[model samples]
Target: MEDNVKELIEITALVIEVIGILVLVFGTFLAMGRYAFKLQGEDIRSFQKIREEIGRSILLGLEILIAADIIATVVYDAQMEQILKLGLIILIRTFLSFTLEIEIEGKLPWKQEKHRTTGKK
Candidate 1:
């Protein structure tokens, strides 16, 4: 029973990681298509919008990958070394997410929507 549970968790984590990779790849193609369309239409802000969309997709993919890492490390193999590695991975991904959010939104994640809605900063 215990081994079955571990196998299930490992499979789940692998599935999540695969999904993340798919999202990242799909999003890249989508962004590329949009960029090409915008370029043909001579839109001045095409690159900016494309960059923002790509960044958003990457951030989302990173989050999903982080989830997979957590599941693999914590649920499938709860060794101290694995946990520490997971922590470092999570930390780096989190920082990347933060930077991407700022780059795409021009504000911090917590502040972006709030400031837009409230007009306070």
Candidate 2:
């Protein structure tokens, strides 16, 4: 019974991973197509839109990965192992989401160009 549960979890994890990879690849192609078709003055705006779409897609992938982690942890039902696995997944997904948010925004939240020009730390 337990072995069967583990096998199911492993299969679910594999499927989730494959779907996430496909999402990333498809998102990349969509962004590339958007950039390739847009012309001069509109290119920047179009690309920015593409970037936002890509970020959203990546976020969705991250969400699926998180779900898979949770499912695997539940299957294990071992306290220490489940905690560690879930913690790691949460940490990684949080960082990925943060990065995607910044990329979607087109700049660091509090970073200023003036700071760069003056070389102040």
Candidate 3:
């Protein structure tokens, strides 16, 4: 039973890792396709939009990869070492995500300005 559970967790982690890669690949392709097809005269704006979309996909993919890393850590023999390594991995990935978010949105996540919706009749 214990071995079975461990095997299941390892498999789950592998699946999650694959999903993360797929998300990054497909998201990037979709973003580039959209930019190619929906060309606008505003060159800078279009380029920036594609960049932001790609960055967003990277952020999400990193988050998913982090989750897979955590899941994979569960089966490691050296619990303490694995936990420390996982912590470092999470920290680095989190920093990357935050930086990508700032690059995409031009601000920190907490400092985002809420758009007030006006009630138009």
Candidate 4:
């Protein structure tokens, strides 16, 4: 029973990672195609829109990947060293996510909704 649970967790983590990769790739392709179609008319804003769309997709993919890493490490691994490594990985990914969010939105994640609602940057 214990082994079965471990195997299930490992599989689940793998599936999550795969899904993240698929989302990232699909989002990129969709954004590029959409922008390309729009660019036929020489729209200057298309580039910015594409970049924002791609950034959002990447942020989501990174979050999903982080969750997969946590599940694989925390649920299946029993070693303290592995857990510490997982912590570092999660920290780095989180920082990257924050940076990406700021880059894409021109504001911090927490401030984004407020800025949108207030129409203030």
Two-way lDDT contest, 2 vs 3, winner: 3
- Candidate 1 Cα errors over 4 Å, as ranges: 39-44, 113-121
Candidate 2 structure quality by residue, lDDT tens digits, 22-60: 887887777777668763245467757777877888987
After superposition, the stretches of candidate 2 with alpha carbons farther than 4 Å from their true spots are: 39-44, 77-82, 102-121
> Regarding lDDT, does 2 or 4 come out ahead?
4
lDDT of 1 by residue, 1-121 (tens): 9888888999999999999999889988889998887642555578787888789889999999999988887463567887787899999998998899889888776764446776886
Worst 10 residues of 2 by lDDT: 38-47
Q: Provide the lowest-lDDT 10-residue window in model 4.
A: 38-47
Error at 67, model 2, angstroms = 1.0
Candidate 2: lDDT over CA atoms?
0.76
Q: What are the models' TM-scores?
A: 0.84, 0.66, 0.83, 0.82
> What residue pairs clash in candidate 3, if any at all?
none
Write one digit per residue (lDDT tens) for candidate 4, span 1-121: 9888888999999999999899899989988998878852455477788988899899999999998998898474578887788889889989988999999879766764536576775
Mark the 10 consecutive residues where model 1 has the least summed lDDT. 37-46
lDDT of 2 at 120: 67
Arrange candidates by TM-score, descending.
Answer: 1, 3, 4, 2
Candidate order by lDDT, highest to lowest?
3, 4, 1, 2
TM-score for predicted model 2 compared with the true structure: 0.66
- Itemize residue pairs with steric clashes in candidate 4: none
